[model samples]
Target: MENFNAQFVISFLIIALGYCLKKWNILKEKDGEAMARLIFNVTLPSLIIVTFHSITIDSSLMMLVVLGFVYGIIVAILGLFIFRKEERRNKGMLGMLIPGFNIGLFAYPLVQGIWGEVGIKYFGMFDIGNAIITFGVSYLIGSYYAKEDVVLNFKHVAGKMGRSIPLMTYVIIFIINLTGLSLPGTVIDITSVISKANMPLSLLLLGIYLNFSFQKSYWKGIGRVLGIRYGVGLFFGLLGFFLLPVDDMFRYTVLIALILPMATSVLPYSVEFKYNQRFVGTAANLSILISFVLLWVIGNMIV
Candidate 1:
């Protein structure tokens, strides 16, 4: 219990430090994008490689990936249905925010602190499918429903996924694991050093990017979005807890992930789709704060 609280406190504090730095003009928002690049391109991929390299591969492990993809689609569909009454512009943003988990940047560090590399492996596998939806499926939805006529170019989405280092790393590592091969010790050692930076860098970048501004008009949309998000969260979270065939650690991981914040990608999607940035930004911020509290409660219960 002490370990969980301590890790949560330290993680939140680092985020607070980044927020303070940004507010103080010590770190600009653009700097957060640079840190994000560092995390996604270098550290996160390294972490995935190192974690997958160390774990034995099994057919059952595929369940983790399947769970991610299936649940994401489910939640996304649910969000679309629940908010069907909203205006066209709001639908895209609402749907975009619903499905993807902020696993790499938000959930993994806390999971690692609580459950170590094994937890990472579970969440890492889950992240593979989450990445697919984030970059591919969710991107399509956002673009498709944009108030502006968006030329649906799947090639563009595919190009974005192709450019993703972490997703590619997942594929490469999975292939290697399939061959019953492990990475060279020296390679793992080198990546270990780089991968270690992922947690703090990710959380700190999230802090730097945090925004809370919102107009009065945004609250109606924001309220409906949050309501649907946690509504789905509560239902599936309980189902996973009581019904999943997985072991305790995987169950616990899934439960925590259920309540994670809206993906940071939502902000950019709002811009791309000509959705309300104020609403999206406000929802994103509130999700972070709300997810933190939910995660703390769940972490204590399960830890």
Candidate 2:
């Protein structure tokens, strides 16, 4: 394989293996939940610690934080406007889905493989703002529109964001790097071993979670979600790539970040806020497939 075809090939093969495991009854889809837990708690944090430990922060990279945040907020507002005629519950469900990207599980693997630690560091900056909206603003949107009377406030959102292991890891490592401090060498050695599993585990998790079934009822809403998600993603991805004077990696990060799968939290939000679970799951799956294909095209173009 030339260029990124190597990583993509390995990724697809692992994902297929995972799906086959599920199909063969060796690993159930629910098994993915346990895998997800491990990834978030251990492997992901380890990757963050090891990757960010020695990388220098570019002042310009901070702009990714802003773009990640601003784009999420804008897409969210657009969702509401587009679905203004939708029911409160449906509107909130769809609106919340628009804003967030699946950076930790989806973006990190491809980036780590293609651009190595340098790209991971840049995407990490972008994810900080993405994390805020994923945990905070999206929660607010879902709760605000739920039929149940739920109290909404900034404190609640902050608490949620504070509890994110990956986000917390990012903040701590970023701060430590800023202060010119290093993690203890022993800690680095342990984390290095654990972090090696992050990418393969993430790719496998995606495959295990895949469901090829889609309902006839879902196409209408799913179409709306995907059409806007990619349509707007294309606009921003192109604009950022062409107009921004940033380095190629930063621009590429922006393009891919905007175009990634919807946030994993959207499914939980559906369950929590009493939206249609089937619809949310199907739409999210479709996004993953579409993003995979788009990334291939984008990768081939840039490489």
Candidate 3:
């Protein structure tokens, strides 16, 4: 128990360190981008391989995956109704923000620290569903609102997931798990070593990307998005806790997964769709802060 609390402190400090590094100009914004690339292409994939490699596959775990997809769809539909009165572009920009979870960067490290491989296994499957919605639904919404002709092709979604390094790694490991195949010991050792770097690096990246600037004009939009994201998320989480027959670990994972900060993808989506970047940045940063505090409070209550 002490170790879990200590892990939170260290994780928070690492994030603060990253923010301090940026403020002092020791790390530039481009450094954050580079760090992200390293994590996405290398460290994160390695971590996925390591986590998924030795786990026992369970039939019941599929529930997490299905529930993940269901949650995203539910929140997205909520966003649609909530933003129904706004202009198409405004609706699209705000609506896309509600569905995705920042599981890899934001949730993984803390979960790893506190819950070990058990946490990763559940969240990883949950993320599979989360990824589909993020790249598929969120992208379509953004592109659609931007007046782009976007088709929801199965192959297109699969191809997009395939092209993503972390997702690809996840698919390969999942196949191996299902087939009862084992990775070579040398391969496991190598990946496990590399995977150790993922947590700290991810935390650091969050700090680097955290922004404090806010435009007064966008405050209402930001509040609306945050309110929906956290409110709906918490409601679903508590509903799952009491209603689902799943064990405590499963319930804990669901609670944490649903309430995670905005997906890091929101920033690039804003850029690609030509929405206001500052607004997205502000909303995302605040979400990160909000999630951290909520985790601390909720973690104490439940754990």
Candidate 4:
């Protein structure tokens, strides 16, 4: 329990420092975007590659991944029906935000830091579920809102997936692992050096993103949006934790992930769909804030 608190404090402090840097103008908005690109394109891919390469998989784990996808899509469909009478744009944003979890970008490092390599392995298994949700269902929702066709473009999905440095890195690593190939000392050294930057850089990007000027009138809508997000997230998280027959470790991990706020990726999608970006941004920020507390509480209970 004390260890959980210590870890939370450390992680929160680092995030706070990022906020401070952005507030102080030390990390300019433009620079932050550039850094975000680097993290998204380069550093993150490297980390994924390295981590995935070292993991071994089996049929059961693959089944879990499929289960996660189906579960996520089901949740999104439910959210859509609930929010259907609302504007198409809002419905779209809800679909994108609700089904997807930030398992890869944010959850990975935090879980790895707290639970070590084994924890990360658990997270990776969860990520397969996350990937399916993000790429499969979330994309459909986003496209729906954008009024794009519902056809599944395997080529397009594959292309976008290919450009994901992290995904490709993971694949490469997984191949090497399958072939029983060890990473050369120099490559390991390089990955170690770059991978170290993933967490701080991610937090910094988040902080910079939060620096946008929020409208006073949007506060009420933002509150409602957050209310829905946290409410559903908590319900599922607690239900999964207490009711599911999963192992203790995965139960706790999924609970934490369920509460992981909104992903920044939703912003561009919202814009494209003509939804309220301010609402999405505010909701995303609030989720981050709420997640800190939620994780602390859950960690104390489960850890």
Best candidate, lDDT:
2
lDDT of 4 by residue, 158-256 (tens): 676666565556566667877988887787678767877877777666667664566787775566556666777778778878987877776776677
Q: What digit string (tens of lDDT, one per residue) describes model 3 on residues 142-197?
A: 76776655555667656776788887788789899889999999998998999999
**What's model 4's lDDT at 182?**
82
| Best-matching candidate per TM-score | 2
Candidate 4 vs. true structure, TM-score: 0.86
Off by over 4 Å in 1: 147-151
Error of 3 at 299 (Å): 0.3
Look at candidate 3 and tell me the lDDT of residue 55: 84
Model 2 quality (TM-score): 0.97
lDDT of 3 at 89: 88
Per residue, candidate 1 scores C-alpha lDDT tens digits across 169-248 of: 99999898888887889999999999899989988887897876767877777788788878888788879988988788
In model 4, pairs of residues that clash are: 45-165, 45-166, 49-169, 49-170, 53-173
lDDT of 4 at 299: 82
Query: Which residue ranges in model 4 land beyond 4 Å of their true spot?
Result: 148-158, 175-185, 211-228, 243-246
TM-score of model number 1? 0.94
Model 3 is weakest, by summed lDDT over 10 consecutive residues, at 148-157
